[model samples]
Target: AGSSGSRGPSPLTIGMADTIPLAVAFHEIIHSYFRGTEESKCQVKMSGDMMLSFPTGIVGVLANNPNPAKLCFRLKNIHRLDNVLPNKQLISINTMMSTRDTTVVDFNMPALTALLRRQSEKNPTAQYFNVDILKYQIRPKAGAASCPFQLVAYWKCEQDHTDLKVDYKYNLHAMSPPSPLLNVSVCVPMNGEVKNVIAMPKNIWNGENEQALWRFTELSQHSDDRGVGSLRARFELDKGPSSKGTISAQFNCEGATLSGIEFELVGSGYRLSLVKRRFVSGKYICDSEVH
Candidate 1:
């Protein structure tokens, strides 16, 4: 839908939108069928790396894209408390985390195992799951904004108007990689407010032709019934002729000093690791092999 301030991109290709959803649908269905079993047929291809043969026993073309490239458009959690029956029915909250709720929705559940003895089931032709993201901060020690994860989900039941309990995890990666050498401190606030005060990564790349600046490539978080549970941070080189240097992040919270750090691709990744460990008293350590 177009709006007053900006026009949205054209609708997504039907095939592309259905790709990840299809995978997620199967995952959920397997979980339902297996119930208490630790091993389920769905586990056959748990990792996206393996090719899976469906009911037809035919394997579809598996894409070679990086695992990180898969779009996690929606994240949901099934809480035991809200079910219709005691220890019987399962209640799941469907969350859509996009700017606009997707109008078209469908669901399918097939009896993947003989133990269930159920045939394929599909939801109605259309449904909607709206998602809202709230930021919460993690205090240095304890504070009103103290939390580990960055994202939150809210849901209300139409029948009772009672607040529905929901949980979700956001796949958020820090734009910067966690440093092995430096101590990194992260503070989560209420409503996705983050006071990042971790020492910057020490640049290791010094080649004349390589880029050597530090920058976060990704940042995200997740929330659920128990509060924040997901955390991630990733950093990459910025454009510039290769050069090496030290960076620092510092912040204070509830009388505690919090810091998480990284040591970058300098000519001396080894030495940088040692210096970083000493820098944050072994706070957020980076991989020694990251040269």
Candidate 2:
């Protein structure tokens, strides 16, 4: 699809025109897996990340175009990029940030023309493109965000009967779109082990001799069914009320960052495919001492 004008190379030119020699060679880059029968769409991977405490934390997003990418490309700028073409050249990376939609970064870097020619001539296949959009700090005392997540638990023990209940919720306000949490898990460290225990939702169970666990495929206000989630368990202890130990939990959520952001590129002649975004944490806890 060569046309009048500068005859410059551009992202919109990568695999966009069947008539172009380079575009015709890598026509398969846009496989069915990327998008059904329809090709010519830019495929990008997107995800969000949040690392912090109630007092302060960092949130960011990662976008990547996988390997087998010499023919493929990504956007440039902001985050660390590798194995991909420069934004104005052969590769492109989509950046993600955790600020509100109001304070997003601008993606207007000039010299974006004539990149495809060099990328195609030198390397036919290489690493994909990925960009980290925007990342910033959030101070609750400054009125940026309140509590990000919350957990409540109660444990009681009698001679032959022991009862435990836990309730959990995440502050939707912290997330712009209030995305749901993924791989959610709740655990309570206990003293003794017990079989034939009773779990309210049936998904909750006893683990080892010192812990009980409850897992959810996805946790959110809408997915909670009741607007909130509550898990309970009843079991008998071999020894009397020894100790309830400590309770710990962890989870990950993809989609939007704490800032609640969105992005777009204009006049690039490139069509950004569907974005894969997410937010995750290794270990997290909510208590009076920690927010």
Best by lDDT: 2
lDDT of 2: 0.40
Model 2 reaches what TM-score against the true structure?
0.51
- Put down candidate 1 lDDT per residue, 134-202, tens digits, no spaces: 111111322111111222222221221212111222212211122111222322111111122122233
- TM-score of each prediction: 0.15, 0.51
Each model's lDDT:
0.19, 0.40
Stretches of candidate 1 off by over 4 Å are 1-55, 58-102, 105-200, 215-291
In terms of lDDT, the poorest run of 10 residues in model 1 is: 23-32
Candidate 2's residue-wise lDDT over 131-192, tens digit each?
32323333221221233345555667776657877665566775545667767777766665
TM-score of 1: 0.15
What residue runs in model 2 are displaced by over 4 Å at the alpha carbon?
Answer: 1-124, 131-135, 141-149, 158-161, 204-209, 264-275, 286-291
